[model samples]
Target: MVRIKFFLFSILFLCSSEILAQTENIKGKIIASGDLVGIHIINKTAGKFTITNDFGEFEIPAKLNDTILVSGVEYVPKEIIVDDISMQAKQLVINLEVNLNVLDEVVVGKILTGDLMTDIENSEAKREMNFYDLGIPGYTGPRKTQSERRLYEAQSGGGLVPLNPLINWITGRTKRLKEQIEREEIGIAINEAKAKYAKVIFEDEPFSETLQNEYFYFCGDDPSFKTLSDVGNELVMLQFLKEKLEAFKIHLEKK
Candidate 1:
């Protein structure tokens, strides 16, 4: 019985050693044509996963001959097999390809009819009307224009009391001031969105200063971005931004 117990223990030790020998911690970098940040590096057999950092570098626990699956937004998934050389070096570099879907070409052109009089009448009717038709305030009726209102305000008090210039403050509608405030608010909101999501969505490798600026503008104009930014959920925002970045990348490529 004692001999049997000793044999079982020896077998268990050998199995454990084999398992440990097969598993290794591999450090690697993800290489791609564009940004590599946030790419997923997954060890299929080991059931381990990691994400690339700003530098596209990652470390994951894997084993020899294990399959590593790499994926990212708008990038085609890649499968890499761990080899003896990679295991010995404790390092690997995986490359990913961008998957761009081709679209059908569309041609748009004007169809001109032979009737000159009818065309002239139609063109005249399509001409833009005055501000009244556009629903602009004070442009349709007897109401004063914005400039007239500001002139009146200036004549009245100039935003200060005559007796004491610092005592009484007059505040009224100033179109220029209102426009400036609106611009400033928009700028603040855009910066906040950028601070929250830009780094993660647009990795450090391919996103340069100009590209970053363009992304900011693109997000500012996107309705979904506005909604996500207001909700303030980091995870959802990250996912949404990733989708938007993919679309933005496609747009850039087309340009």
Candidate 2:
């Protein structure tokens, strides 16, 4: 029984050593501009994978002459072959290149209905005449002459108290307050639009939390975003988002 146990121990030791000899711990650093976090380091031969940390450093199991693939969202994929020198050094450094994907040029043409000024004049002719556009028979227009206004105010007892200026002040303040409220409501609507568009863009992708946040901000920073949000038409906003998404995809592919 003692002899059998010794033989088994020897076989186990040999197997462990063989396994260790076949696999190498490859430490690597990814060098690039911007954040290098979450870059994937894969050893296809060994079927092992790892990712870069915040510092752009990673470690993976590889074997001599094994092919290792390094890739990131904003970079071109790179391949490295492990060799004796790398194994001796126990470390490697990879520099990734920006993969710029160019999109096809688009040509847009204007649709003309008629001469712009003529069309405006014709449309104006069709519009109903308001009090200001067409003066009343007895009154001059929406704004009466100063003398006429004062005479009317005097007859109504409004001129005695001089409440016209005070009423004007109150009306101006009310107008300003309404405008402020409208601006705040528009701001809230814009934020909601950004969130909704972000969900639509990345709904199908499996992204890390950090990446999701980054992408959400990226969508918000799109040039057309503010304009589309201000327009406030869902169909138009959706179309604009789709176009922006295509551009963003190309940016990511090329970066």
Question: Judged by TM-score, which candidate is best?
Answer: 1
Model 2 lDDT, residue 152, Cα? 49
| Overall lDDT per candidate, in order of appearance | 0.63, 0.60
Best by lDDT: 1
Model 2, position 216, has a per-residue lDDT of: 46
Instruction: For candidate 2, give the lDDT.
Output: 0.60
Q: What is the lDDT, from 0 to 100, of the residue 147 in candidate 2?
A: 43
The TM-score measured for candidate 2 stands at 0.34
How far is 191's C-alpha from truth in model 2 (Å)? Answer: 39
lDDT of 2 by residue, 1-255 (tens): 999999999999998656545767889999988578767665645544556888999887666777777767677667798987888788999998775757754535432122222222222112112345546555432355444454444334244676755664556743554455445545555567655545544555675767556554565666566666654344456556556666666777888
Residues 136-198 of candidate 1 have per-residue lDDT tens digits of: 775223455455555445445443444222222344344454555445545666787677556
User: How many residue pairs in model 1 have overlapping backbones?
Assistant: 0
Report each candidate's C-alpha RMSD, comma-separated, in the order given: 23.0, 28.1
Q: Estimate TM-scores for all models.
A: 0.35, 0.34
Error of 1 at 75 (Å): 1.3
Q: Which ten residues in a row have the lowest lDDT in candidate 1?
A: 119-128
lDDT of 2 at 112: 16
